[model samples]
Target: MSESTNLREPHAQLVMAHGWLLRGRIWQPLQQQLEPQWSCWAPDLPGFGSAQRPPGLSPTLPAYGRWLAQEAKQRAAGVPLVLLGHSLGGSVVLHAAALLGDQLQGIVLLGCGGGVYQRRPFARLRQVGCALSWFQGDRRAARGLLLNSTQRRAVAGLPKLVSQLAMPSLWIGGGNDQVMQPVYVRHLAGYAPDHQIEVLPGAGHLPMRDQPAALAEVLIPWLQRLASPRS
Candidate 1:
């Protein structure tokens, strides 16, 4: 379907928030897979993709979270909205879920941040490198920096806040993800014991890009189950 097609009107609205530095187009493959059953809205986060950065904001995760919350509130409008966020977008959805409360039906976190708090010293250097890349107008670099930063900030507090997240959640991880790592995924599983976890084989940091069909195969069923009437 064309980018202009409104995916929020008739079917269940699937809000697919992209990771840092990437545009909404990242979701195109998955969107195509879901087709008419799921209308996808993948909006660019502030300061990234096609979305403009808000004035005076630091373009940090918290700032993005607030902006996303407001947008979801306005656009969701009582619809059964399901949130699927990648990397930094994962962390954004977490904060948005907290802010939106009952308005959200479920959340899917793909190669998510906020899974582990501490990292090796080189990880810090990686972060520095990412920041430098952003200054050079490299969005992919900026995205990496954002994901790393979000993970660092949210990891410590995530367990506590996750307990308060009553929404049914799903965590998708790349088995070969060098960035987030399997240890982090294990930590996430322990934190949200009730939530489902799926690991994509042969996938990297961007599982949606690497394994769109695999991701969708896992995601669509969960969305449908969540949409079903509860006993």
Candidate 2:
């Protein structure tokens, strides 16, 4: 009954993807708010917090997207998964959805609005991130994550990701999020005609940490609507 198998499977309830350098636990609080009504699956992608980089694995954005598609498929036993991704994870799942096709019920991007970066700033930002990751270890795990995060290869696919998607897409941003503010979120929303935008007022970059209750309120209703028979 798995989506990965030859047989077409039923729709998945939901699956969550965390941002870069983070573990599956990132979705714990969110899960707590929505559980009993719905269950969530959060994977620790390779080279992130608790997950080690697999040997010889390509650490590019496209590679991560393909990997997440498989992971979501495995968890989606006969059901189209309602996919949610945070920051870098959001972008990753966008690419993942391209592969998932009808197996995905819908897509939600939290604090990650896709857009092309200004060349000079993006390069400098990438350099800074890589430097910090290099400071973390000699294995270069962090560096790879940072690279995929800010690379043009990732942004290059946004139009394609949006164009090919046929499901409802939601873009949620923190009102106070300096990293990906409303302007940035707005930019991301424009790319996908099917997307709905929600900015959590008074919430910062990590709304799950800064204002969990409010974040839950914003998220739960949309999910319920999705699960309803009317949807």
- Candidate number with greatest TM-score: 2
| Model 2 TM-score, 2 decimals | 0.87
In model 2, the worst 10-residue window by lDDT is 3-12
lDDT per residue (tens digit) for residues 62-128 in model 2: 7888888887788776676888888888878887887887777788888887577567877887777
- Cα-based lDDT for every prediction: 0.72, 0.75
Winner by lDDT: 2
lDDT of 1: 0.72
RMSD of each: 4.7, 5.5
TM-score of 1: 0.83
TM-score of each: 0.83, 0.87
Clashing pairs in 2: 10-78, 10-79, 11-79, 11-80, 12-79, 12-80, 12-81
Candidate 1 per-residue C-alpha lDDT over 49-98 given as tens digits, one digit per residue, 9 for 90 to 100: 65666565555566667777788777877777788888768777877777
